[model samples]
Target: MPIPACPVVHFELPYRDAARVSTFYQTVFGWQLQPMGPEMGNYILATTSTCDSSAPDALRGSINGGLFPLVPESPLQQPSVVLGVPDVREAMARVSAAGGQVLGEPMAIPGVGDYVVFVDPEGNRLSMLQPLMG
Candidate 1:
């Protein structure tokens, strides 16, 4: 059997000014911005399309994302896409085997899933997420 396909389920971008970026996207694209608390790194969740709470990925072709405060020292400060994987650990191994570098250990996102960043062979920054099952 062929390997399971991982889909781009989310996108993330860093922002210098939270209010400015939130207003821009909300006013221009009509995206609903939900500001998370400090416990969750103050990440701003952006809902670009309608979704079913019972099923996170139930709405095919529709993806949501988050906006994070930009940290100049971090390597993953640029815009990037997040691929949904069934197993983040396995994906990390695959990335390394394919000559890509896993940036760090997987981090748990409360109410979300395990997530880890990686760099592809061509140096593009990306992430893998193993979402929590209900």
Candidate 2:
């Protein structure tokens, strides 16, 4: 289950004001935004469900990602770069075997897909997705 080194990571939206932008996304895309931490009022990750709202992050009902405040110092690259895989767990192993590091664990998203974030050996941020059956 070794996935080739894909060229995409994720589509990141740069927001100057997270609260304002996150609210907009919640209404427009039906995405759920959870506060990253108390100290990070302006920092939040967009999700497909609220805490205790639905299936695990990997089993959610649809493809989804996060929303965070824009950091001027960070690199700028947004291009709908989420990679689709057949099995996240397997993909994670393949990635690791290929010298990649898992940025996060596989998350279920109800009937949508399962996914995880990782970094390649070349320092590229990416995500792996496996759509779940309805």
Candidate 3:
């Protein structure tokens, strides 16, 4: 059978030290890392494959993610996959019904759309994102 199209859109990981974690991945995997300023919460954009960062839509079967500062109080302080959903609110409800726990309420990213985190029944962390429509 063919693979389903609900591919993982992005991934994320937390780090106690952004520079150190960025360097580790860059050195080990040769992935490109772009550090965002304080306004973006010191997030590091990780480019895992050879896709062009300037035009992400050109890539196929590939994804990249960000490295965020670890927050002691946050449940999102673990590596997680961000699945693209058509509606984050609906996804949250579905997660709850499917024996998963939604971490918190969905929040709208400045230019992005709604995003929420969750933990599967087996306790693996994951996230859902509803991209901003054009």
Candidate 4:
């Protein structure tokens, strides 16, 4: 049996200036940006494509993302992709066994799921997410 596929479901970018970054993407690419409240770390949700909730696979091949404030001490303050997995812990173990470094423990995103950041062997930052089931 082949291993299950983990698809890139989202992208993230760090922004020094929220207003500038939000305006750039919105004006240039027509992305819809929704700024979250402080409870959500002031993250800006970027919707690059439309999807119908009532339809299955409505977001196939498309993804939405978030813009987070850049933290000087954070190594993950760079553009990265988020891969969806069935189990975040299992995926973290696999990443470590494959010579990647799991940065820290998984953090829960409200209404989303468990998420963790990691770095590949080549030092590329990425994340894995076990989405919450309805």
User: For this target, which candidate reaches the highest lDDT against the unseen true structure?
Assistant: 4
- Order the candidate numbers by TM-score, best to worst: 4, 1, 3, 2
- Candidate 4 per-residue lDDT over residues 39-80, each given as its tens digit: 999899999887635476465568899999999996768899
Off by over 4 Å in 1: 51-60
Which stretches of candidate 2 lie above 4 Å from their native place?
1-10, 19-66, 69-80
Candidate 3: stretches off by over 4 Å = 1-5, 52-59
How accurate locally, in lDDT, is each candidate?
A: 0.91, 0.65, 0.84, 0.92
Q: Which ranking of candidates, highest lDDT first?
A: 4, 1, 3, 2
* TM-scores for every candidate against the unseen true structure: 0.91, 0.49, 0.83, 0.92
Write the residue-wise lDDT of candidate 1 on 10-62 in tens digits: 99999999999999999999999999978888799999987645576555578
Candidate 1 — what's its lDDT? 0.91
Selected candidate, larger TM-score, 3 vs 4: 4
Model 4 worst lDDT run, 10 consecutive residues = 51-60
How far is 19's C-alpha from truth in model 1 (Å)?
Answer: 0.5
Residue 62 accuracy (lDDT) in model 4: 81
Model 1 is weakest, by summed lDDT over 10 consecutive residues, at 51-60
Model 2's TM-score against the true structure: 0.49
- Between candidates 2 and 3, the lDDT winner: 3
